[model samples]
Target: MKRSYGFLLTAMAFTLVTLVPVGDLPAQQATASSAALPFKWEELTAPNFIKAVELSGGTCIIPLGVIEKHGPHLPLGTDLIDVRAVVLRAAQTEYSIIFPEYYFSQIFEAKHQPGTIAYGERLIWDMLQNTCDEISRNGIKKIILVSGHGGNNSFLPFFCQAQLASRKDYAVYLFQPPNDPAFEAEVARMRKSKMEQHAGEGETSAILAVRPDLAHQEVATTQSGEDLKRLESMKGVYTGIWWYASFPNHYAGEGRYGSREIGEKELNHQAEQLVKVIREVKADKTVLELQKQFYDESAQPLKTRQ
Candidate 1:
């Protein structure tokens, strides 16, 4: 069955509203203080929302998260919390209207685990499409999607491509920032454990930086996250059960060595990357124009030049 997050999104918007200026950035930061505006959708007043649209250049961000079990030690909403933290921080600096918490994405692999909310696949698609459409109707044309869960990596791209199925007014940009080589080297030096994909060292450390009280480093060693190697002989094959086959516990790495220092580094890195994305998206006009051109040609492909 399909579920709607309309009520939840509205409630989240209210919780996020804050008193801030929502106007264009001046040539100098000194002038920005007087003209600055709140960058959250729920925070903006009806009047201020108009200013925000101008200030943001019609740009808005939806930080996608998922509710799933991380491990016995970490919170179930680990990905959602961490990803939202980064996007919120970035919005403060770059000034884009931040959407509320959105956790609708692919997580069927973790359905067996407690606290996992896996919606039907079709529902995920329609909800995202309607979300973007509604955002456009509200006047924001560029919708940036910053996903917190790795499981969404596959679904998000396909959703973006499906936009071509029909003409739309807005452009959807997925935030897939590339890791800095220097930063990766620095993390390698600071990291205590090599495996940090799931609720492992790196992920746990990031949570500690964002919400230390929720990160239970002591209980991190309660479960083993080692791969069971059940499908070693079928290495070339790709299957939906590959994740469960390897780590039925749904954990991927060691979290016992998570540290706040590493967490700070990782969190700051992601925030910085997102900050860049917001600034770039705000300045972008080519994408929408190109999209319009493509849609026009797509409508009359028979007339398109060879």
Candidate 2:
């Protein structure tokens, strides 16, 4: 059953109170002058929210994740935990409004898993679109989507592309960090297992770094993480059941090999990269200008240049 928006909002508020520390005064009661403005959306008071939108140049970040099984040892919210950690760290360095826990994403493949929360396709789309619309309504003009879940790779890009289908006052930007060969080499040198996709060494290490208490490395070997190769014969064919066919256990790599050192290194590197991205996005004006120009041209296609 889909949770109501009211319930979700209330749940999110509760989550903020429990997970985020807002000092002596409650978040809503804290004055802007009392302390430094927090980057979290839920933590900002009504008055400070307006200041945050302006302070961030109408820029906001929605760190996307999903609720699903991540092997046997890692928690279901591993992606959310790690992504939020990275985004919060970056936002502190380069201020931006970080939206509260957003896990409503594509996770149909993991529906068979025990802890997977697979919202309907239509609902997920509407939820994201409405969220963006509401964010823009709140005076934010530039929205950045930083996704942590691998399943949202295709979904998020498609959503960004669909923003062009109709005219919008705000611009949406997807964060795609460029590859660093040096960092890749360092990771390769540190990791013992070469096969890693989900709940693997890299992912487990990430959880270890972010929330070591939640990571149970001792139970990592309880399930098989080996690829079943169920669809090996189907070459050049893309099937919806590919992931399930390949990794029936929903475990893809050797989590036993995960180390805290590798986890910290990866998280730090990602946060550093995100800090640069936020800085760049805050200074960028070309996207919005081009969006407006395109919207105008698109509306009158007959007058477009040949």
RMSD of each: 6.0, 7.3
After best superposition, candidate 2 residue 254: deviation in angstroms? 0.7
**Candidate 2 on 74-148: residue-level lDDT in tens?**
989989888987887676556678998899999999999998999999999999999999999999988999999
Instruction: Give TM-scores for every candidate, taking all chains together and pairing residue i with residue i.
Output: 0.89, 0.88
lDDT of 1 by residue, 54-142 (tens): 66667889988899988878988988888877777677667778887788989999999998999999999989999999999989999
Candidate 1 lDDT for residue 157: 97
What candidate 1 gets wrong by more than 4 Å, as runs, is 1-33
TM-score of 2: 0.88
Residue-level error in angstroms, candidate 1, position 211: 0.9
Residue range with the least summed lDDT across 10 consecutive positions in model 1 = 1-10
Weakest 10 consecutive residues of candidate 2 by summed lDDT: 17-26
Q: CA shift at 154, candidate 1, in angstroms?
A: 0.3
